[model samples]
Target: MTTETGFTNVDHEFFHRELDAFLPDRIYDAHAHMWKRDWASFTLGADIQNVGIAEYDRAIAEIHGDRPTETLFLSFATPDHLDLIDEANAWTADQIKGRPACRGHFFITPQQDPEWVRDEVKRLGLHGLKCYHTFADCSPTWEASIPDYLPEPFVAVANDEGWTITLHMVKSRAIADPDNLHWIQKYCRSYPDMQLILAHSARGFQPAHNLEGLGKLAGIDNLWFDTSANCEPIAHQAILRLIGPDRLMYGSDLPVSHARGRSLGASDSFIWLYEETPVWGEKHIRIEPVMVGLEHLRSVKWACWSERLTDQQVEDLFWNNAARLFRLDT
Candidate 1:
């Protein structure tokens, strides 16, 4: 049976059978989000409305059990709700108060003054910045270029402050696009102190793109990747093999992680299969999908197995890597 929060018997079984043994004793969630419902332009369900640090802890416990878990909380707000960015970021900062092991990122838009953003991040005591393509001034944001949304002025502030920027890049070809590679290399090379984290396995939902592009991104020490809700094994496997596990950290992608579905790599693209997707059954057989978080963990397990990573290396993927990046005492 599934709970109101979306955890189900299927997820429990999947976790115990496939993930319990593979997970480390401590987990550092490098990516997750928190916000108030009123701050969003879109309607949020009562279950997810007003999600704060406490609520996040409760939701994650369904998957993490009693194991100690810390998070790098991201501020959440859609493009239409730009007016609420300050409140949303304030909420995130408040949620992480007193939780030294945890950190938060200020949500940024391209139009904001760079000086204001830098001062705001310091005022909120946030560690980094989070930028999305939806805020870009483009017709179809999915295909927007890096600088279209994440302006250089903001990146310069991050570089000066030595802050991390969690970037969710967009394009039809993901990282394989020449423009994407050029911009990524430019920021990391020019801003040696600022760190750039590519979310969703470098947006490698389509593993073929990662396989084709990750090798080209080699030798950049400041570039990192987070395995956040990307269910394809090859996506994570390629990063581990080509980039090394030390530069890869774990990210739950929270609310999405609780969703019941998985992302499948299609021909040069990817598709998300939800619980209501009609392809789950055929003839007399039925397929029951677990939570995306569980599927994500399973994918990590498969990738580690394929890469023959040691237990310590696996721990680094789950915890140590992020700890070292955030300068958290272990």
Candidate 2:
């Protein structure tokens, strides 16, 4: 029952039954990616090679239907493609220009000069910064400290400009890790103007990390989170209950959204089950996995339901919160 677009009959049914009525009419995707295929050092499928505004619109429609969508488009570049960083960031700026509702973030590396980074962001008209752990000069970069990639200098510039930073932090224990907590606290406390968005529910693929650490992060006014590609109900539920819905935003994590799989919390960590994952089923029955986007929507619905959030609160997660943060016209 898989369609030409990669969604299946199961996906449609899940959407209509579990998500259609629950979703608001407007959406502001707070953490989607945009990149050129050729710029990638690794291989990209033809379907996602040219993921600019147009491709993003079509991809989001598959999940959001006819809802009008705005986005915070993150420029995509990996450590392998560091040489093309400027070109990739410029392309992001070009794609989002003239689209007032949308905004873009300049991809930055730790090695770049802080002054140059600030000027480049201003020149490109980008609203903020997007950084990843891969750029850290450490073996097994997953465990690298936050400062290794997103350095203090870059943060100072963001604070000066009142820019937002979408950070996908990595460590074995995620937000609960002592080093992660220290840097996050230092940055937000020292620079009140810079808004810090903890992407993927603070990388809470393991909900325990959120439950264990979120209590320590309370009362930070400039901190926020985006539910990007995370399918754990408790990870988001914890945020709603602890941080309030005003600080939580919905993110499709597109391209990954198009993939057929769901991320699951396993023991102290988490694992992703993809279409090719052999554990989809056993001898008793078979299962057809839906799109990750559908699974993510369902998770958000469950979190809202568990927290008994009002419709207005739900709207805030999907749209209003982002609008308020970006100062976009509603």
**Who wins the lDDT comparison?**
2
Error of 2 at 323 (Å): 0.8
* Candidate 1 structure lDDT: 0.89
Backbone clashes in model 1: 0
lDDT (tens digit, per residue) of candidate 2 on 18-95: 888999989999999877776663222335567778877876888998999999999888776668889999999999
The pairs that clash in candidate 1 are: none
lDDT of 1 by residue, 1-330 (tens): 766577779888888899888889999999998877777532223455678888888888877777799999889888667788889999999999989999898999888999999999999899999998998999799999999999998989999999999998899889999999999999999998899999999999999999999999998999999999999989999999998999999999987888888999999999999889898887899988888889998898999999999999999999999999999984
TM-score of each: 0.97, 0.96
Off by over 4 Å in 2: 1-4, 41-48
**Alpha carbon lDDT at 230, candidate 2:** 99
Pairs that clash in candidate 2? none
